[model samples]
Target: MRSPRRQPVAGAATRTGPPVPPAWMRWLPVCYVAVVLILEPLTPVDWPVSFLLVALPLVTAFAHGPLVVAGATALAVVLEGVLAGTPCCAGRSVGYLWDRHYVADYVCTVLVGGLGTILAAHRIHRERTLADVRFVADIAQRVLLRPLPRRIGNLRLESFYLSATAEARIGGDLYEAVPTAFGVRLLIGDVRGKGLLAVETAAAVLGAFREAAHEEPDLAALARRMEQSVSRRAAHIGGSETGERFVTAVFAEIPADGRVVRVVNCGHPPPLLVRPDEVRELDSGRSGPPLNLGMLLTEAHHIDSYPFRPGEQLLLYTDGVTETRDANGVFYPLARRLRSWGPLEPRTLLDRLHHDLLDYSGDRLQDDTAALAACLLDGGPRSVDDSSEP
Candidate 1:
């Protein structure tokens, strides 16, 4: 029979608590079961004293629902108390060790050890369910954060991502792409911090962009919507200044049939212009601050337009990319390094850059790194109006 899926424990997680486990953390349960079996022989005393295996089932029990926990607890009770031999009761005569009370021992085991196991396993089951929910959240993000296309404008996109943490979860760093009336609008931004709060902000920004791209004809309006979304979120949190959350971002909209692109630099790193033969930063031509910083700095975001020629691609990213430190503690120079590697497809570029970035950091990051590359297609060749031709 199929094992019923478990559910997360309600009313357990506080806004501040232990971080959830990653999706790849399945082996932890198997490890838990193994530990239980190893120490089940002397539970509550030797088991708890030796290895705290009792806590394992308790935590596990908390994770699964009542039915599942009941099954596991019953099985463990039978195995440990009945089959494995319970301790002799009350020094009842040396001969009584294997006496007729065996049936009573079985019942006692079911009543006592079963209850204990049920409690422990329930906790564990709750934890596992919570972890599973968080994993699904991370996976669902990939849908809105689609992989960048192979080509844009005339440039070949090559991008890479590496989180500073061991668990490969996306947080703080964010990116997006959507077709608009003008052309394709893209964004790459970073929340002020890491973990769930940052992920939530990232989600809000992308969700707004996905809807705004199709509705807003002007890039300026699109930027405003995103800015409002962040502000609204901060307000919803209803915390003091120290409790406030914010993000820095860069928004860009490329024209369908031209070299002109509009960008709003909301306190983010400037994008780099990379070509087969040249590399330079796209002077954002603004003094505007980041999105959430607007409330603090009191500056209106300015829309800056720049030239995006064919054969040249723009690279946008979170600070994690350029700020990565080496053994000597020197930061990575993405502009110089990216130009050194010849043009590659979006996937290849992301993979290559991700690999090289990890190599620089020994495949581990202390923060999340997000990079996006958008290249203009057709270079300088006369391009047909493919939008309407089809």
Candidate 2:
């Protein structure tokens, strides 16, 4: 059996943490130096041997810091001097100290080297500033959507989130897990829009869920509480935009000692039930309208229950996963693709989906994607109130 506390989720794309090549790779410029040296003797007098010297610093800048570039510049200047004294087309060495050709060549080499060094330093400063900004964004993301624990009681948990906007660490997609008095309550959702407004709505929804999940006894009641919270918050929004905001969500509860999972869908995509023998979608007949739009529907939200036996897995995801399209506009067939895997642990399942989604989209997605996978362990669920007793 897999370890309960170990997380196997693939990490999100990180912009601020660009990979640095190995130390040995930095010496690649040494090969270019060799090429330039050999080419100098073979070229004709009009070929401009000093032109190659200026390239040394430029090439070095990519892998080395300003200090290293300065060292390279010095070596380049030395090589230029050597070239001036070497034999040219007429078998006579090119003039040295006083010749205008050598003087101009040396000056150009110095100028190019200095400019390259400055550029390298500026690049380093810009990267450092970006890193600081990303650190702040990471903190904000954690506060807004708290990270899910790898293990909660007897269930193994794994989650993945990818924002459509490049360089944006967080987006409107959200998920949260709360060990409440009733059971381990979970919420996965997607806001109707994107950008700052959507993020604010998402934050409001999560805050409401965290507070109410502990008080509600059933998944339907919990979903209604969340709907009320969103409605109340949206009511405060000014102008015609107030009624336009809404959220698609799926709320679930895994009881403390039962092998069953209760779900209340709110105009959201259905969750998948993957077992060793088969894969199926948990299509709840009692599903209702999305949050903030419940006034249109007269019936109370339906609560659907399904067996969640040991070694089985449940996957909750936003529409981003199902609606992703390729160049030909073909939607990602998640259920069809999932059937091929038979059964897998929560983390491994998410990891495979993450890569597969990227491959399908050619590494670019039209919307943000978020997924949560939970695997039932071979034991009775621990009481949420008294975990120490378990």
Candidate 3:
């Protein structure tokens, strides 16, 4: 079933340009000038305290734009003249304003100010370019990994995705759920490598799953189709990396009856079954080769079925979730976290998991992560006809 597209979490971290400086930072040039003015009258004239104003434009450039830096430069030159001409306790004369030493100070201030203005302009241009690049990346990510529907048939779904790169919106991890005539078919996988190539591989896998989920009745056959798709994509890419490009994925089918869930594991992390009493891993005794490497396996892929009655939640995630490490290098305890929590709605379960994972890893991830949480609601479809209800 199709649902409205929504961000994974309400307050999830977003990729943005460099942070804006604090308000206090913006006033630093003014503060510096005030300090200079206060010290000029009290200090000895030999100190040439007015010459220190040359730094005004440079300081302003850090927090302000080109125009502000130029203004600060002009202000510094005028203030230097004022201080040179005004009689202080040292009894300086107005003739000192045109003194070669004072003139040199003014020239130096203007030179530094010109450089500061150019620096500010370059910084602003780079920020705008970075912003444009991030925008395009975000759009591509949304298109490749469209948000999963909150409700598909009798299942309540919630999903989360995080890229390891702070400025990247998507990476190697991917997940997709489609409600088909047979049931709700879910796919979650991680590409073998990082960067744009991995993203492209993920896109190929997801495109294949979305198209084949409705057509393939058997989980094994669906997996085979994915393998073929990945193989063709690799062939098209055609490089030394082609041999390294493979995906570990899990395919799940939640039947209309909502009595059981069938899962096919392909060299991927097993899904966790979270029940009110206990949590279980739906591990297929025999593991299948990952996509693009299916030819290495002579035996058929293993499909395991486990009871998935109402109130039970199934959590599907890439290895990135479990492999996340703490400051001490300990892997995240995914099952323990699930077992400790009381029954939670699908969205709440995933939201908590997302925050917990980030907190456990010190708010940094070594790999791209993706997760899908599905809770079977009460009075779910009991048959094919019952599944037709909206």
Candidate 4:
């Protein structure tokens, strides 16, 4: 459902690791200076105390601009000069001015500090460029996975999409919910492959489903339309490799006036029906093959009908969820997990599943995941608040 504008939380779990050091770390150079002040007086000046002076400016360069680094370098130079003239060693300002070792240490600090400042400037520029590119990619992803309204007719809806790759914003998984004359139609599917090829196929399927969901009254017919669309896309892609371009999908029809839910399964995982009393899988007696394989099948696709009582919720997801493996290589038990939740509201149901899936997989999904939860509201289809609970 459409939440307020914000950064996407999906796939964020994968970024979990060491926390970034705090921004206040920029003051570390000052702390280093204080430590040097205490240590230089205690230790003999002949212990090469001036060597420690280079560290303050270099550390400052990591978290600050060149100006700050320059200031730190100047401070280090002053402190070195002062330390060289201390009673611990020479005990005369002329000792630092004429001593070759003292002069050499000061020269090294200035050269290294200047180099660190230049490197820091370059790093900041590169980071800004990378951020701009990533921002554009994120926008493209949001456009691809447009936010679904929380309410469509009397149906409460919530949806999430997670791309498997860390560098990607969108992938092969796809889901769409459309309100039509027949009812609220839903489609959640996974393309056979990843990257641009899969995304192209997903786009074609969604375009076909949107157009046919309103025109085709029968759920099977709508699926056939999607099959044709995928076939055409495969033909256009035109390679021996494109022959493997089929999509596993579950197409659903929730009639506005009926207590029945009709589904057409195309080699996809069965959806979970979460009722107050029990959670059941809406299995087709014998499912048809995935989209783009109608020509290979001897039998026609069949639509399966099941009761969808009011206050009940239906959960549909791509194989990524069920097939997600833990570090120990155990598949996530989606049906069993749903049974534990009883009858949760749409948004909360998806949130729990999203978090649970990431936790189970150690936040590393091997395939793209997409999930949608729809609750059949009483009093037929009508718009409601963004989070209309069941």
TM-score of each candidate?
0.61, 0.87, 0.90, 0.86
In candidate 1, what are the lDDT values of residues 149-174, reduced to their tens digit?
54443434444445565434456788
For lDDT, candidate 3 versus 4, the one ahead is: 3
Give the lDDT of residue 370 in candidate 2: 92
How does model 1 fare in lDDT?
Answer: 0.62
TM for candidate 1 is 0.61
Each prediction's whole-model lDDT (CA): 0.62, 0.81, 0.83, 0.79
Clash pairs (backbone) in predicted model 4 = 153-381, 153-382, 154-381, 154-382
Q: Each candidate: RMSD to true structure?
A: 9.4, 4.9, 5.1, 5.1
Alpha-carbon shift of residue 223 in model 1 (angstroms): 2.1
Best by lDDT: 3
* Residues 247-290, model 3: lDDT tens digits: 99999999886589999999999999999988999885677988
Q: Write the per-residue lDDT of candidate 2 for residues 278-384, one digit (tens) a residue.
A: 88899956678899998977988888899999999889999999999987999999998899876777878888988788778777678889999988889766766
Superposition-based RMSD of candidate 3 using all C-alpha atoms, in angstroms: 5.1
Candidate 4 lDDT, tens digit per residue, 238-287?
Answer: 98876688999999998877878899999999998889989888885688
**Clash numbers, per candidate:** 37, 0, 0, 4
**C-alpha positional error of residue 177 in candidate 2 after TM-score superposition, expressed in Å:** 1.5
Lowest summed lDDT across 10 adjacent residues in model 1 is found at 3-12
Give the poorly placed runs of model 1, Cα more than 4 Å off. Answer: 1-138, 148-160, 242-244, 296-300, 379-390
